[model samples]
Target: MVVLAKAELEQIALPAAQPPMADVRAVDLSAAPGPDRAAAARTLVAACEEQGFFRVTGHGVPQELVRAVEAAAAGFFALPQAEKEGATGEPVGYGCKQIGDGGDLGWIEYLLLCLTSAGTVPAASFPFSTLPCAAVCTERELLEEYAAAVRRVACGLLELMAEGLGIEPADTISRLVADAESDNMLRVNHYPPAPRPEQQAGRLLTGFGEHTDPQIISVLRSNGTTGLEIAGRDGAWASVPPDADSFFINVGDALQVLTNGRFRSVKHRVVVSSERSRVSMIFLGGPPPGARLAPLPQLLGDGGGRSRYREFTWMEYKSCSHRGRLVDDRLRPFEN
Candidate 1:
């Protein structure tokens, strides 16, 4: 864990600039199944087509569970650097500073965990087991509960997306995520506060670099400290207001391909704050490694018009994405 000092942050901080607040669409998922649910689905589809991002409320995840998991993650992140490093593992565990093996760096620290189809965290990758028995038990339980709750929310949202697209079975897209072999992951990120406002010149520290998710979808919730920004279609960045109670969704590269270019894969990043830490938990929903990814025939016109992206397996796309920088256009090679 290489923590950056104030001087190091200053050297990398970009000039401060205020971006316009994005008018992100919000949908209420608790609507009863009928006209209300239909309306909500319509809204979701519009949001996906326009920005590939939206905020969701009434997601059914208990606020208490959300808070508990956040607290546990915070406690772990607050641990001494050496103590936290004990839980480190390959691809899944505690990581700081370095974003990926490609040498991308960020002003962030994170815990990455994988969830099985059974909704259980693999004990082999458990980061809390090294702690006291009681602490480990509590943390593990909280993480499992949180993962289950969020998984439900993610699947439900996918079902609604399918509905809005007027697709058959309404699970055409969602089944990929609910599959027994689905590759799902949860990441908890902590961006520490920067130096005092007066100590540094006007600048913003990059917490996470701009990038599009390689999975099918991503659901994120963060402590109410603003820093998130998403790039618009025009290629300008806009800030997203923090809403702790609602989960923000991001359409990923897989989904963009699946929809035959109807949906977009949003690019986003986080900037560090000077007064408060930002803690975010993101659930990345992915298909199995062997799952074939291509444009849905239903989305293509009756004659099955040309597919914008070439067919590829999830593993191939994931491998391609891993070899690039954070801001690289990962889907270029797959484009037709």
Candidate 2:
């Protein structure tokens, strides 16, 4: 990854402007099963339809665990560039600035890890295994624990969505994410503060470019500093207020297709803060490579209504998404 100097950083800046706060819905995941749970499910469905985004409270993830993982991430990113680079691996390790081979750049550094079916990082290929911090078992433990907890929250949300949609089996959607060969992933992003010159100019740098997740869903948690924004119904950007205690859920492209357009896959991006750094942890829940993807029949009208998207395997869609730019309409090629 190429490190940008002050001049290069300034060149990438955009005019700073505050966006209106999004009127995002919040769902209480701890709601008990009967009428309460049903009501929560309805709200979740409405949120998905309205913004393809929502906040989750009573998610059951321990605050201490979240903090521990954040601290560990801070420690890892604080290492010298060379040391941090040592953990780099193909598509699943330390990355700086450049988002992908497609030439997209951001004012961000990140750690990407693939999770196993059991929700644990593979020991042999652990990205941090060679770092000095590897000896600190607590760091690794924190990652595993955090992944497991977040996965539960993600799957639970999927089930709630299925219930609200009146799908027969509540697990119909969650099952893919829980599959033995699921391609789940965890990403930790660190967006450092902008350069002083850029700050003085009141310019905002793109921490992450706008794009929709290719998986079924994404669960994200970030520190108090705000930078995240999602596209509103009018195609204008709306700022998402930071709530470290709550989890934000995003409907992914796969989910949008599965629901036959009833749900939307939102476009979101991040801008860098001049004085504060932003750190976010995201859990991307995907299905197995071989799993078939198509609009669920239940969502279609009687007599097997026409499908909006052509049938494709998860691997095929994943490949297509990877080959395109961040803002490309990935679903266009598969559209009927």
Instruction: Give the alpha carbon lDDT tens digit for every residue of 1-336 in model 2.
Output: 336766657655767888899888999999999999999999999999999999999999999999989988988888888888988887698999888766778889999999975578876546775555645477778888999999999999999999999997999999999999999999999988776663437678888898999999999999888999999878899999999789999999999999988899999999886477788999999999999999999997722598889999999999989987898999999999
lDDT by residue (187-294, candidate 1, tens digit) is 999998876666557778888989999999999999888999999999999999988789999999999999998899999999876578889999999999999999
lDDT of each: 0.88, 0.88
**lDDT minimum window of 10 residues, candidate 1:** 1-10
Kindly report which residue stretches of model 2 are placed more than 4 angstroms away from their true locations once superposed. Answer: 5-11, 133-136, 198-200, 302-304
Model 1 clashing residue pairs (backbone): none
Candidate 1 clash figure, as a count: 0
The TM-score of candidate 2 is 0.95
- Native-referenced Cα lDDT, model 1: 0.88
